[model samples]
Target chain A: MSPRDLAIKDLKTHDLTMREAARASSGARVDLLLIAEMVRPGSRVLDIGSGDGELLELLATTRGCDARGIELSREGVNAGVARGLAVIQGDADIDLADYPDNAFDYVILSQTIQATRRPKWVLEQMLRVGSRAIVSFPNFGFWRMRLDLLVNGKMPSTENLPYRWHDTPNIHFCTIRDFVDLVDEVGAGIERAVALDASGHPVRFNLPWAVWNLLGEQAVFLLSRKG
Target chain B: MSDSDTTSGEIRAFEPARGEADHPHSAVLRFGADMPLQLDAGGVLTPFQIAYQTYGTLNAARSNAILICHALSGDQHVANVHPVTGKPGWWETLVGPGKPIDTDRYFVIGTNVVGGCMGSTGPSSLNPATGAPYGLDLPILTIRDMVRAQAMLVDHLGIERLLAVVGGSMGGMQVLQWAASYPERVFAAFPIATAARHSAQNIAFHEVGRQAIMADPEWRAGRYLADASSPRRGLAVARMAAHITYMSDSSLHRKFGRRLQDREGRTFSFDADFQVESYLRYQGEAFVDRFDANSYLYMTRAMDYFDLAADYGGVLANAFKATKTRFCLVSFTSDWLFTTADSRNIVHALNAAGAPVSFAEIESDKGHDAFLLDEPEFFAITRGFIDAAARAVGVN
Candidate 1:
């Protein structure tokens, strides 16, 4: 695969929408399955940056949920529609504000949050449209990412962050701690959290936030607005 | 052998210039005064007929039937050779034996709308009472009335639910009407290059076309048939003007580029100097032969009065509330007539109504006419959406 495809693939293991190329590959993606688990069966769902609608299809068929998506590229939107899914061409930064509040039961932003220009605004919009928001991202503070940056004194690039420093689509890279802080600042609370190691397995079940932030290469969270 | 059967005194069979009464390629279903059609214009049409053509075979389950609606000037000959012009079907690029809308798999039915001048009942059809053409006396038709007429035909064919309804432009309006009027009967709708309501600019253009036809002395207040005259020039000019909106500036530039028509130098006269001018004249002349002046007036008026949202208490979403039909709307970048923004507005309303909908604004410079051309991306979307909807409805 090309570097761009590699970056998107690396991003997809956590974000169901970014897994454009990996959408056709064998078994269910671990992170997408994880996000799907947090969603209540038969609930309405809105998947942001839903590239080609692989996860939306999974949600609709497996959970019997009314699933829809907002994608940025027309190519992705058309492809998703071809699969007989309700996906429209829209941007995460702009179009979310147009949706009515509480329209969906769950609003999901998978591996794609890191690529957004305003993660905080997008999180708030997702929360506004849905009662619950599920987000997953690659943890920038992972041991390997940290070691590579600290020792090489260069921008860290790994399996999770495959793009070179210049061409990376990730504009707002955030560690698990950084994301948690943003969630709190946005007046939301994490209802459930799972940190995954490099191989996509849950890491250090009983460990503290700091330990999980360092060891976990990626993370998924279920969030809700504060009462 | 003559298409003049519909014009003869005391004639019962009404057909277009290119359609002969004995042609086996199409069929017409007649509904007498007992089975009257309710019109949106607070009038009723009796003793009407719907002309249609069927392609492929109907499956035993009756679930494989697809209805393909035609645009303003199109007729029932969707995938067959035109009996008049001897040209391939207007949508020859999309619907054929092995095309995206595969005739080998699905039974496709194309209908000449009620207000159309084809073999269908329209202003051109002879009035049974007067023994003369209906002309302006025929009750004004709307998109909904056309759909109701189609519903009767579907009932006549013994199909309770259609597998899908597809069209572009004016036909797209009919598709929207189908989804809104009888949501349960339509499994899927593919409306391309259309808007929920006619734009003001479109109304203005239609007005120009109407005025041109009415201005002609030959038109004789839409009683040209009684006067034994045809408003050929007036109708041709109207067609010439409307045809400009169907193509893009870039396409026009590329196709003609201010080039002279069959001459190296200007003639210094009004005789078709430019290639574009020559092309538009040919289009106008060709249209006049196949279309009726009075039918053109009613068709444009119906389009101008169409406002889907107005009927649903001022909310477009209300028109599609709880609709189970799957929808796929396609638009082209260069289509300024009915733009991508128009398609988006419909998509937004569908989303608000919780309808399963997909929208694609294909990249093309072919303007509004792109939907009728060989667009591969559009073909793929049509094939994919139909195939998927087919599976959902267990058509196979």
Candidate 2:
């Protein structure tokens, strides 16, 4: 097993609760836990493009949040529903408009914004439907990816983004600095931001956007609408 | 030979059939003069009977009860051997021991609608005042009327609040009606391949079937029982036409195509030259054996009269205003009869009402009838929603 699995096994052996074991085990995706941590307990949440409902399950089971999901694929929606989560088969770009304004306390898009056709519009919709929004995505400007592109003369393929250039669903990829600029353009206030390195460890940067863009492989942000 | 038999010798095709109205395989609930059912089409029905079949055990809290509503042609024998056809029940694919419905965990109840022929007070039953078949005399029933009678049955069973109400097609309409009329009484609803109201195109199809049945000389002006004749051919043709609408072009192409029925090549006379024609002939022939012609007219008319949004000041969301009932609406991608747009309309209304709802448009070429078949994704959602709802309500 991987080192993460061994640590989770050790946590389970030490009689941690299922939620703790789950949180400790890295069972839910790393970025999903980060999003879940940002949500207040017992808040209403909607997860767009919630593949298999891993984050919804985390929010509901651990935080007692009223979690719901929208998935684009029939297979993904059915899989989420089979796991006892309330999810609908719908497109993130189209179906998000159906939900009323301020319907949820927190609207989340984790590791999925890059795949969205209109990232700014989706971010605006998330803020419209929820009092707060949480978004996480792989940063395209990590040093290793830049190095690979410079030396190998090929499109960057790092640990966080392993997809081939042609078949990748990440059509609108952005660097950390680029996302921060887009967030500002959409009149959003970033209340909290975390930059994580390759090993799922937060870089703990109080530095500039350029430094975070070059160092962090992934980024998560908690935002609210600015008047 | 008896005088009645001799008089109607040529029309002996009926089953002699409406016999189930009295001697049915289900548990019958009879209403006396004290319990008159008020219908939406402007009158009341008295001394009626509701035939229903039950599976599993009602929990001590009665919170495990699930009421299953049958479609236009279905009856209460939802998960048993049909008494007339001697075949498996209509929804046997979804409801049985260890099935997705899981009889071991749910007290599932399937009831024949108020206008249905199978042991229910329908057009085929005897008129208590006249001692002849009610026929057209039975007050017109609506989807609301069907659900109203079902509410009575639920009350009779001592279930104040049902854990869930589920169905497909016309049955799904009734499920929506339940959500609207008795919102507090239902905890969850599973409506598959359904809509809030019957579409204009659907009404047109039903009209075609109605005309076919009415045009038959054997109909005797809807008093066929009094004339001792049944419109077998007309009813069969009606079923055949409606059956075509229930399937998609792709599925039809896959199942029957332009292939010959048997014999290598076609004899090409006015015979069953193609396999599809032969198959339709079989369907129509088998349908007339078990269904009542007059009941067909009543069921179709009820569907045509359904318009829930019109009743609520032209707003569909108003019908479900502040409803606590959890809803899961599903549609098939190829169901032209009740397309995915219909399901989305309901989803939008529920979203407007701020009700908890989930919707899915499953990919299948089997058309509207896909809900009745063994589709893995459909079954998984069904089982999961029920399981999760059970946990929410604290049902063991």
Candidate 3:
């Protein structure tokens, strides 16, 4: 069976137990757990670029949220739908605008921002449609990426950023500092932000922004419209 | 048939011919002179009967029953062998022992609509007062009436609530009507390739078909049964036009595309020189053999008059405000008749009412008939939606 089919089958067989394990596993991806933590129980959520709906199922079962998702690829949507997630095949850039204002309690764009054609507009629409928005993406200014560019003289690829530069879907690559600046420029308030290391754990709880930007391999931010 | 006969197993009734019977697959629900159906068009239909078929076995909780609403030209032979066509049921692809509907898990019911000719209390049925076919004298039906009749049947079956109500096209309208009319009874709803109200262009097409049927000389003012004649020609033309609407332009072009008929070249006459013409002609000819003319008119009229929002003071969300039913709307990308926008509109209303709803726009060039076709995306979405709803309703 394909990886997607296996993932769906795994979900169908395991249900809540597997999800609980994934949430509690220290080896689990920190971004997914952090996003799940930020969302309140019984809230309405829309997950953009909801790949195979792993997070969607987590939210619905663990958090008791009314979860819906919009996945870009047919395969991802099929996998999600087969696992009984309310995932529709849609483009995040074009379909996000169709949602009504304040339609969801939380709108999540997880590790998919850099792939979007219009990342800024997508964030703005997410804020407009949801009371709060959560976004997570791989940081391009990690120390290893800088060293690779400085020593190897080529674009960097890490465990999180697995694709080669030419074939990568990360169109608008952004560092932790760059995303923070962009969020400020867009007039949104950052409610919480976490910079994670390669092992999927926070780099430093009380570090300076520049220090965290240099060492953090990935970042997650909770944002809301500025008053 | 005994009362126990109607409750379990297959019970055939009213089978006069192999394919020409009123009710073929199961027992008929006969209403005496005391219990008359009060129609919206201000007429009383009495001494009537409703023909229905069932699949799977009802669970002890009686909570695993699903009501499958048939479209304009559909009948109660869902998930089984169709008596008239001598073929598998119309939805056999998605609804069977192991298919998406999973007849092995749920007790499925499909009833002939009130205005349908398939053994239901339609224009073709006999009127006790006149001792003849009701024909034009039959009260104009609506989607709500059909749903009400289904509710009566559900009551008779001792099912307090349905796990889900599912349908496509005109059948979808009944699903929506069930949600709106009896919010508590319908636990979940799947309305595919349908809109809250018929589009103006759709009404125009129905009007043209009605005019065709009415213009036939053999119609005899819908008294053709008494004269031992039928309006075959007019019904054929009507079906031909409606068939065109069911298919997409791209599909027709791909299937026919000015291809020659049987002969190599045109016969220099108005004959069916092109393959598309011949195909449509065959469709029309085949349709007239099974359908009744007056029933066609009534069914189309019922579809045209369906406006759920109008019944709820012009706000679609109001109709669903009290509804606890979970909804899933499906539409084809290339279906101009009931486009994705229509499903989106319904989704928005459901959202406004704080109802749980999902919408899927399956990519297909099969047009409105995509619901009836073998679209994998549609099947997956349906399976997912139904399974989730089943879990919610405690259907093991």
Q: Write the per-residue lDDT of candidate 1 for residues A1-227, one digit (tens) a residue.
A: 22233333334344543353156444777788778767889999999988988789889977899999988888788788778888877788987877878889999998999999889999999999999999999999899999999899999988767799899999899998898789889999777777789988666345567877898899888889778
Question: Candidate 1 falls in which docking quality class?
Answer: medium
Model 2, B1-396: lDDT tens digits are 000100111223444557676556678888878888998877788888888889999999999999999998899999999877789999988998899888999999999999888877899888989998898988888999999999988998899999999999999999999999999999999988988889899999999999999999999899888887889889999999999999999999999989988778868699998999999999998888878888899999888888889989989999999998888889999999998999998998987787878888888999989999988888888888888889889987
Which residue pairs does candidate 3 place in steric collision? none
TM-score comparison, 2 vs 3, better candidate: 2
lDDT of 3 by residue, A1-227 (tens): 22233334333433443365565774445578778877889999999998888898889987999898888776677677667666666788887877778989999999999999999999999999898999998898888999999999988877677799899988999998899888987888877777777876665445567877887888888888877
Highest lDDT model number: 2
Q: What is the descending TM-score order? A: 2, 1, 3
B1-396, model 3: which lDDT tens digit per residue?
112123322222221111233434456787767777778888767766788889999999999999999998888888777666667888998898888999999999988888787777888777767876777888888888888888988998999999999999999999999999999999889999999999899999999999998899988898876566788889899999999999999999999998999898989999999999999999998887778888899999999999999999999999999677888888898898888888878877777676766667888999999999899888988888788778877898
TM-score of 3: 0.89
> Which residue runs of candidate 1 sit more than 4 Å off their true CA positions?
A1-26, B1-25
Error of model 3, residue B148, in angstroms: 1.1
Name model 3 segments beyond 4 Å from true: A1-23, A26-28, A149-157, A163-168, B1-25
Interface Cα RMSD, each model: 1.4, 1.7, 2.6
Instruction: Name the DockQ score for candidate 1.
Output: 0.55
Best prediction by DockQ? 1
Instruction: Calculate each model's fnat, 2 decimals.
Output: 0.62, 0.58, 0.31
lDDT of 3 at B104: 93
